[model samples]
Target: MKQDGDAAVNVPPCFISNHEGFRGSIKNLIRDFVVTEIDVGGRRVTAASANHTSPCASSDANSQSSAQFKQESDASTDCDVDATPPSFDLSVILGQSVSEELEQFVLTLKDETTAKQELSLGCFPDKHHRANVHRVVRHRFPFLMTITIQPEIRVREDPDYRELSQLVTEDEAEDFFRFIDAKVRGSSYTFGPDDSKEHRTAVHHFMSRRFGKLVETKSFSDQGTTAITVRLREQGRPKKRSGEERKEEEVYTGFTLRKENLETLEAISYMAAALGVLPSDFTYAGIKDKRAVTYQSMVVKKVSAQRLEEKAAEFQKRGMHLSQIRSVGEPLRLGRLQGNHFDIVVRDLRRHGTSDTHFSAANAHTCLEELVKEAVENVEARGFVNYYGPQRFGSSQSVQSDHVGLALLKEDMVGAVRLFFTPEEGDDPHSHAKRHFLQTDNAKESLAMMPLSKAKERLMLRALNRYGTGPDGCAQAWLSLPHSMRVFYPHAYCSRVWNEAAAHRLTTLGHRARRGDLVWRQEGQNKLEDAGETSLPQIHVVTEEEEQQGAYKLGQVLLPMPGNTVKYPENSMGTWFQERLARDGLDKCRFRVSSLKLNLPGCYRPLLACPCNFRYRLQAAEDGRGEVMGGSSRSDRQLNGQTGEGKQGSLVLVLNFDLDSSCYATICLREIMKCDL
Candidate 1:
């Protein structure tokens, strides 16, 4: 009953069920495992259900015009509307004679075709009058950007100058430039002289929003005043259909992402490439299993449904599909899901018996059904030990993720870097580059040999080549990976600790609420999303009185993942956590890697997890045809490579269940199968 890979991570062999488990293989076909995410609203996200039109889609022509009209009215009320000369109320702010002359000037400027046309409103003696003129020009004649020189208001009709007087601080400008560098190509912005950097930065941001990366910007001093210029980059503008425009109103687009045999990130990368956006632009509630066909909700910023629809064929060719594409108010954040519904098929089942004799298909099916029922009943009654699955520790026996994490925690950058570059067994594409680096200690050469698909490795190698393999270089190399990828090592280590601690708690204290144990202060508030990487959930330590009163059940108790800020239990479990960390050459203080900005502020997780809506079906595989249970349609089954054919003379077990967020279905399967997963 020992767990595979437990030696590396100290995960113990344990099972809550005493019912005998039969031999079976899972994920024989990609379709054998189907997962659909359950959103926060407790609605399961499925492919079939996602085909309906989204309510947030853009309205028809008439409704769009009405919306536009309403927006314009709102703008007018806010004093932000672009008013024409006829509609402008210049007389309200200026004398009639002056207003008439200003209106005439505005008309002249509007008609001028020159790249830059300027007119000076003879010095307004009063500063208040000058301010009013500036405001009037901004709201009334938005095309004519104005700058005040002393008491005189000078108006200019420069296409780039329009709406360029808004403010953006230096810090904001720097941050925007960084974003542009990271996410854009051939894009830049410039600001106009208001003698204010903030105003110029604001203008730059506006230009960026309007033109995106299609244009670049530059600023220069003109007569002691700074002015910005935005021009098309060398790449030039993309050819667009007539009347086709970007939907500026669409900030975030929510869509159902269905992928087969691709990890969530990998699928997102493909979608992002097809849509011509960065992979980081996509956000999902959780990462789904790679080997399974999964359907989940995903959101991308500034991407329209039309754009996504345009890539439909490409996505289909890649075993992916998108549906229910619509505008959403916000992007999806990780761990926002309530849970996931699993439709898993365990094929090639063989009942465990006193003798190794093959049973008839009928007897085998009946026996397996009874066994499955008992297992399911035991699980529903006693629950299962919530251990982090083997996937969390990684598939490599040569080196686990927690090993790199442990090195990182000890601040052994060189060791961590070496571990990262360690060559794995089998035909790994990165092995040659890794071996080259290890042998020659040449990051540049190693990078040249590295495959382009190994993006994280290439990034680290580049950092190392540029900075040299010193402490700082190593740190930079590790940090060069995407935030999600970089943090996984540390998080994996935390998972290892949690798994070992949970096992120890189960073996020593049993599965019962005890004094000094920690439970979530509020039910359903245990936002230990993404394994406590984002934020800490509120928890309350169990008092002796509460323990004796049987106030908290075994499922209510939680254990803390080691971190700098988390409080440990007052019982022996807490002491065991400290002792375990000590054995691993770590302490709570070491969890904070200040230089790397990797702080582990730990969170709590329930030691036990029960499957909800649990149900199972056993079918005979004598004819190599097995039926799938749950919500899977025939089309879905076919798309996932389920051909209704499995091993002959074998029984198939189809399990349908819903697990809470952060719970691993693999662990649940292992508990039922009583075998290494």
Candidate 2:
């Protein structure tokens, strides 16, 4: 049990502030205000928005990127966007949003293509938490640029290349020669689908959407697969050459990856270990799916494209193919992508049938397509709910729960250590074994299981195994873990609270607040800017009715993140969220613990999600490619309820949508699936 003293000390010094000086609001951007696919607007991607530019090997590459940004800024146009819902009975979708006016539920719906077959559905998913460290940033002053030899793993590639190429869409695949003509300097040498006529032979089979488990399509064999074929800039070691004019070339390398089941983190870990470099040496912008066959770029310092190619066979054995090898002068950074072009295949529509039912084989294709089309159009009109993805919370993993981070924030050293060291059965044996031995006081035995792979956890365990239990030991162990990993837990807790707060606001207020309700001011169109500053005045309540300021805009609704400096909305829904925090044994005022590196000052996120460039297409699986495994598994049987109404080798629905880097694609899909909120 947590002690009283711990709670008292945990209250941040700022909690004492009356917050009476100014009744101004803390402004924030809606979390779901993502740069949609339409936002890309056929503009060439560029390095202008990159976090940092390194002195590299190429001048033309640098010049081209800068030039493209200027040229493309005006040329940028949104993709095909539906400003309003279509005339065809949008009552089902709108009713799904509010839930009251529902004369048209899924029960009444029947597939038009397959003799009016019923439609089955599935839902959204994620592994993300962008930390909000504004509380600490506030105390530091106007601006403090402390550049460390920091090694944060995330890729940032030049966008111009992905944009300039016609490969951005399925339609662009037609003109290979035109694609080559407009390609950048090194792109001609890179391995692409258009490289050989054979590459295009079975392009449909290799399409990203068809590759998922839902549809068991034989991936047409190809010399070069589309495993994130892109030229990325690598920051390399500049060795002094005894030449007349010594210079630097921006060493560009093609960072390609294709793996199933293994996540990006583990892949980077394996690659780093194999190369004898620190795991931090590998960086990429986005973390791909662990279960899905996803591809993305990665950066390795000093590792030449040639060296990576030579070891490609060895790398392949590690379960992931890397090809399309080349080098560039600019290194990829995290949070630096226009958007992901998704080709997701949703299978098992026929399983929604009342029984092992009957429908025409040819009709199966048209039926699935229309149902999928309805889902796609619905998502396009009303965006998905921007809930925090499932990955943020702990499951059966070593970092058992984010509560440990909350404990640390509360200054409950004992509680933090207990949760951190507690070993649960059926968990990661590596973490479990070490923690078990440490708690058992078998320091020597624990060391055996504690390897470099377990560095973060071992640091804490090592301290306890040697020094035994105490506040000093616990504190030291907590601090020893990498800053990034340590921050994730507390940040995750904050996200959970934020998600609840968002949900409450949307459900209660019809996605907007009434006059006199506490609402946040807009800091910017797409960012929560001010709460990060240490100093913030007491928040002002919203006097203007939401409808007065165009109730439908993304800017109108921003929910506060629980923290000390941030004030709760003076309304019933806001009180509900505060009660939720208390129920979780958390206090908004305890966010600022002076000694810790991060503190959640609390900011606002959008209450709703409104995605654009939302598109989907339903298609019949080619030949024996698409198969429904719904009846085989117990879970699938439960999901189907009634099964096999259509043909054995049934149809599949393909969903195509673009989301912002911070947004969850799963949430968007969840909205379409109409699963429980």
Residue-level lDDT tens digits of model 1 in 212-258: 44665667787888877665544334324364654553357888888
Give the residue spans of candidate 1 off by over 4 A: 1-11, 48-251, 273-276, 353-359, 521-538, 588-590, 622-648
Off by over 4 Å in 2: 1-258, 300-313, 320-334, 350-370, 394-400, 417-435, 438-444, 450-470, 476-480, 516-542, 545-556, 563-570, 588-596, 601-603, 620-646
Where's the lowest-lDDT run of ten residues in candidate 2?
A: 122-131
For model 1 the TM-score comes to: 0.64
For model 1, which pairs clash? 168-198, 191-228
True-structure RMSD, every candidate: 18.5, 20.8
Q: In model 1, where is the ten-residue run with the lowest total lDDT?
A: 71-80
> What would you estimate as the lDDT of candidate 2?
0.44
TM-score of 2: 0.54
